[model samples]
Target: MTRGTVILKNGKVFIALGYSNSDSYPSGEIGQMLVKALSNSSDEETVQIIRELIGGLQKDEFSKDCMESLREIGEAFYNKKAATKVGLDDVYGYYYDYSYVYDIKTRKLQIFHFGQLEYSFKKEDFPFLRLVVENDELLYTLSYDTKNKCFKGIDAEVKKVKRMKKAGKSPQYILEIAKSLSERIHYVVDEVYSSDCWPNAVQKGVTFYPSRKRLKFIFKENYGKWNVYIQLPWVRQGLIHNCTSRKAAMNKLIAYLDGNWESFQSGMDLYELYEDCQQKLMNFYNACDQISITKDEFNESVGQIEKEFRGKLIPLEELDYSGWTKAFGPDRAKKEIANWIFMTHRHIFDCIQKA
Candidate 1:
């Protein structure tokens, strides 16, 4: 895969180009289709098809025709000299066992960003939240390997869960939590942490900060196969530097590092104060763990669970949410339903804006 990443200030925009490893694909197909998509009457449809053709598979395993088409499409995005000379290639293709592609098909394509990375976001008000977007029942298998020193693999076989009904469109349900934070403009912080597993986070996507200030997001994928991430260090650091005290800075810093309220809020005082700023920063980020059991962590964690825990878990449908009515009594359930309705209406404006 020929991949490139260009981080621009303020997240105004960026672009990326990459190839699917599907051997069935040819080199220039991605480039060629990108050009065709830009010119097509239905830009969204064309782009969707192109994205699926290249991104919807694992590495080097694509149809030869697909790869060639993508390469040609990628070349069309830039001058022959520029596209040909861009020294982007996938080195961990043999190691990570997966691939990614990011493309910015607009303007002169001043910035193209691409990497196998992942990150998450939430409103400052909601902290104890988890978002479950898309029900991709991924399964994982275990194989012994001395090279995987970072994580202990649970010996298992590769297989899919049987007797399971596939879910339709993925759900984007994530919990939300909030905390008070403050920050000044123009500062950057770099932090290093360990992965939650041997393989680090291997996901990729882009974010836009539309605000009228310069910003930088930098990170290196040194963690593990597909498990690396980038963050707005300056933004995060600036917030830390301006807090009420060293302790406050430490708390907020730890919060960001943990990314989950459940993990961050455990076994600690919410209002504890730190006496030293440097110490606080060091202490907070030093403990951050990079590994996560997110569904995407594997192409098939669900299969592993089903195969390993055959009769331990019940069918999802059996746990009827409305069953709560019987347990708590119908009147209470009705009251709860009324509260839900009220909350829904109150948040209608927010939903429309997001939509």
Candidate 2:
């Protein structure tokens, strides 16, 4: 059997006794037991009963309605005790044991464990109290409201953590290869275009545009792998080849330059292609200045269109008609303008025929 108590404001005391397994004894038998226990019990025994009741309340071992009544009674007891300059040891037990203390001056409840002060809570700031057993030791956690000058039970706070991806170092072999390849490409480009100008040196590689060529050579590290490719004028796609070893890539580049160098001597210039695209786009935008769209809106639409084009190597003939219509609207002039902008800025890989 488990027993508890409720001391009301009117000085009426109620003893709550019950079976631990949710069973109930006959009311007559319970009444007799309570009567016998209190009939000639000592002051120490009565105080022990009250202490057990408060302990049960702290442990949340009662129903919601019963718990609420017990809390009120506890608050009354503590307030009265505090007013009379009586310490919690007189009512609950000795300070050497685990117990709660209410200071009259501070109106704060101090929780102690084996004479060690564990936690303290001001009367106004007291959250719902929860007693938890961790590492075979009893501890308190915060939860619901304490506006009624009593601790109620609720869930404790939960912490969330976000994990990040671990960083890794690049391979030493790959770094060495990239450095060697950059120096080799720079040497070749400088040798080839010595009379005209020097090759442009980028982070991982070099670029050289031979005089009057439709295409330019770009050797660089892309997405961690080395690539030596040919970029064509006014074309979204390029002739790209990936190489793992520096020697293989250099051999391929030299062979392509040897075979195509004569053809590149007389063809469309790279700068002319860029200037033409810029002029056409500007002219189209100028013609549509009366339209309601802002430059930012046009740029956003163009970016979305470019992304769709880059996602796949779709040819000009087999282009998705509905996609661009959604981006630039149903107006024919706007669609035409957006298409031109997309063609100039969109990226392509291995689509040599389209270029």
Estimated TM-score per prediction?
0.18, 0.23
lDDT digits (tens) for residues 255-288 of candidate 1: 4433332222221111111112223333322332
Clashes of 2: 0
Q: Please give the CA lDDT of all the candidate structures.
A: 0.27, 0.34
lDDT string, candidate 2, 1-355, tens digits = 3232222121233333122222111122222232232332453453454345434442344544444643444432323333235455355332222334433344344444433444444433222111111111111112111211112111111000000001121223323332333222211232222121223212112223223123355555555555554433333222345776544555566565544443333222223433454565455455444556555666675565445533322232232233111222213323443566766433311131133
Q: Give me the overall lDDT of model 1.
A: 0.27
Clashing pairs in 2: none
* lDDT for predicted candidate 2 compared with the true structure: 0.34
The 10-residue segment with the lowest total lDDT in model 1: 175-184
